[model samples]
Target: MEKALVYINYPELIPLNDKSTEYDGYITIDDKFTYRIKLQVPNFPDVKNITYSGGRFHYIAIQEEDKLFKLAYYDIPKISSELLKEYASLNELFTTYCNCIEELQTYFDVMDSIDTVCWVIDPPKPKKSDYMRRIMIGHNVSIQITFDPLNILNLPQIQFMGSENGVAPFRESFINNLDNWDPEYDVVQNILRLIDLPFFPQEPTDAAKSNDLDFKVNECCICFCVQLENKLPDEICKNPNCEQCFHTDCLYQWLSAVGTSRQNFNLIQGECPNCKTCISCRIPNI
Candidate 1:
């Protein structure tokens, strides 16, 4: 089948089971969740030969220097027949898992001081020895289920691990689901109520609200003249109290009228752009 083109330039894309450098499709999921996870499979060595498996815990290590996360392994857990029916992959299951955790955290405000984002998955195999494909979640909480390692080893290599990306779609859907979930009024209301953030859900705003959103540096105080032909354009204004620097010639002409514009600075106690509080400044006359 013809594969799609990807424009990502991530240098550490390998060793994460990114399949042959030229390959651009789903990779295998070691026999765990019955192949529910299908995404960019990084190259993992020596995982398929063993069985004694159920659900595996997956790990993704943080690479601070490269700003990329390395593919850690997933610890697949033994899924009951009931769960397999509903979830295609563990990542899909996590959406509900995370949502429930978040809801519980926000509503109760007592997450046992443990970072709540932690849950079970396969752990990285390269860095650790005596690797177990047990389903363990959370860094702080070593919650895990035992597996039959000897039984897993008897499984055929091709059969033990799926060659295709079984869980990729579930990962894609779980991570990017928010792209389609727009924050409509009702969604916002439910989220606010469920998560209990301090956000005041306001209605459609008017033009007056725009003033708060302006990004211009309104409070600048320096004015200087520059040779635009030789460098950049020089501009000046008489509001010496303003932080905006002006061109020398422009400043001289504006102040030349009353001499009140000498190196002298004039300030008016005026209200600020947002809170209407009086702000004063001595504009630098350069």
Candidate 2:
């Protein structure tokens, strides 16, 4: 009869079984923020018996949950001391839980905005408390942004990745437009404004895929392979007419076998395999 009354008053919470010891529901605050929650209440009146089984807890970092739980269970002295009559009601406990979750509104807001706009490359999926993300911004280009969880509306620390030539323009634009960043906008919006892009690049289309397959410019002339040991043929012959490509290791080994090859510090001065033109290979650091 008591469990039936509690369900009638708090329709948001649904019991898992006839015993009504477990519940699955959501807590909505001010009709704006809602978080899914699961609760196990073996001893209803004893707050300690109420165990949080799942929901937004998974969205947040494990380390930060302790503080939230403490806030929910112990922040109110009367509730913790068992002196308040309202503590006997599950509604009162859920209200306190909702208040604690409200404090994390900014974190949830920022994460939702990021998910809507960015293609997160690293950590593929992010927690509500994850402050860093690497997102694809352009073709073969990405930018790593470390957000300030407290000041999410402000500019984040950003590092651009890809070839030097590819990322230089974006880097330059970001530096020049730093003052133009508007804190009123979301993180992704501010970043797009700074880089002057309408939106982040999506995955390549079928036409782009076909174009990429049309060339084997990255293939190694020595090993006759496109990639070996996860490395492309990065070493190229200086001769414009005989611009053959070789992996750094392959070139170094070939040059070392020739008696004419001379080692000067970390450089191997050698002849091109095709043109016999003077070329050099920088001995890659092991």
lDDT of each: 0.27, 0.62
Provide TM-scores for the models: 0.16, 0.49
Report backbone clashes per prediction.
65, 0
TM-score of decoy 1: 0.16
- Judged by whole-model lDDT over C-alpha atoms, candidate 2 comes out at 0.62
Off by over 4 Å in 1: 1-20, 32-208, 211-286
lDDT of 1 by residue, 146-167 (tens): 2232232121111111101322
- The residue-by-residue lDDT of candidate 2 on 79-196, one tens digit each, is 1232222334444545555554454457557776777667665545665546777777764456778876656677889987543455678999998999988888766778987887
